[model samples]
Target: MREIELSLNQTQKIRLKRALEKLESLSSKANSNSNASVSISDSIPVNLEDGVLKGHGTLDLNGELVATVCGVVERVNKLVYVRALRARYKPEVGDIVVGRVSEVAQKRWRLDIHYSQDAVLMLSSMNLPDGIQRRRTALDELNMRSIFEENDVICAEVRGIQHDGLHLQARSQKYGKLERGQLLTVPPYLVRRRKQHFHHLEQYGVDLILGCNGFIWVGEHVEVKDDMVEDQVSKPEQQKSNKNSISLEEQEQTYTPIETRQNICRIANAVRVLSILGFNINIEVIMDTMNLSSSLNLDIHEMLGSEFCVLVAEGEAERRSLTKRKG
Candidate 1:
């Protein structure tokens, strides 16, 4: 039993991923019993292929297959209930899900997460980390949305469930605005059902929230920089000694990485063309608009780069109709 839980090596990891993928598909739709007239048992019968029904059972909590119902197996036992197969990482007591502030509600922020409405991140529920005894002032008149601004991305905890939607709390420094960097979303199904961990980019040094609803955000760890304080000192000699540090920070600026800038520019240009033309801008349009990549036949390689701007401004004036219409 102990060995069963041992870590899987890389090859084993891939194999397991493949196996889980198959299991996911197979478990989605159970096969019907061989004989049609028998009605295939009322529920999922657990008949193994070419094997006898070991007995009617349920796959129980402790991960052992156990019996829930009693009946004669017409064929192999394949009937099943409780479709909680791939329990990879469902939301639980204190999971931090990354979500964008969708809309400002009366007292809460409605986030457009793929979860079961916009999950509510209640203001009062936020971290008074030193606990209830840390109440410094009158807390009754606290407004919810004031703490969090509109469209601000927040990392929040799955405080609990109130209604069908998830309840959230963001009292800690861990749960706050995501700034500077960008976010990326993977398929919720892929993320939730990953038997293996979703690969993380170590270089980015960012916080990630894998929401049960499939929303993911990766960005610089705001409000937590270890070297930030050391970067500044009042003494001239100390400041002179850290000239390299200043240059390092400056080096980090001046230009975004090449590929990142390229992608950003390309996406911006695509949006520009799309909005300006008010039409479908194909590969041709993207290339032409960006002015970085070629529009010629073999330019497909340059078409895709991930630097997409979160927000782009609308134009001031419509391209004055260059129309001299003659049929």
Candidate 2:
């Protein structure tokens, strides 16, 4: 049996169960139950006479379509594929992903992006800290630690997989090392890819990066500095000026305000609650959850209490029901 992780009393548990049941009922009614899942080697129902095409996560066994993994069956036109929820992330081109640097190898960083293998981010694929556009030299390779050290969290885009392995590139300003934040990991299925994954909550001064790989980052808003070097003569002096400045310890001592810390906790907890409830995690739903907590004036710690969990479940059930009705 699946265990519910939340600490709930009898009444809260009952309410949550009822709310979840209602949600499941509503979902089944809105869509065809053809999304039925099958286990590995199980025969999937299909009209073989109509020319069925086996896709990913499927195998042809004696001219029969068999599921290669345990997952929900999806049909796109004539193609049939199984979408496994508990499997490693399958990277697609242009997907924004958050990963931790596991190794600083020669001219590349090995990133753990929750895939079958570690993703590689080549040094030549990314921009320099000073944003200079030129051929990378041995000095740049020597200074690789300056850009990303082991265990540093980074956000980048999936550049197609090569013979080496899954490749990533951080060519844009937004794609680089993340700092002053918290990283939250949830099941990748909970997060749906949307047109916009990067959200800046101006109200709370928080930057939220919802990685398609299920690694969510909530951090302090960082302003992107203009790196255009207009004058060639003064560049060296400016570089020297930067080298003489603050140490890492001094920068680390710059404390974050209590209010910002509280806000971060609030948003992080909001994501946590949604993930626990198995709700679709999008920016709008996250904002709604955050607003609900703020409107109720609930303590930051109270947001994860049993009562709040039940309330959130009920709210999600109601929200989905209303959406179903509209459709």
Q: Point to the candidate with the largest lDDT.
A: 2
Give the CA lDDT, 0 to 100, for residue 226 in model 1: 23
What is the TM-score of each predicted model, taking all chains together?
Answer: 0.42, 0.87
Off by over 4 Å in 2: 1-3, 33-45, 57-70, 226-244, 247-254
Instruction: For candidate 2, list the clashing residue pairs, or say none.
Output: none
Kindly report which residue stretches of model 1 are placed more than 4 angstroms away from their true locations once superposed.
1-91, 105-107, 128-133, 136-146, 163-165, 193-202, 205-207, 221-327
Q: Write the per-residue lDDT of candidate 1 for residues 62-95, one digit (tens) a residue.
A: 4333444432223333443332222233566666
lDDT of 2 by residue, 293-314 (tens): 9999999999998788788889
Q: Clash number for every model? A: 15, 0
What are the lDDT figures for the candidates, one per model?
0.42, 0.83
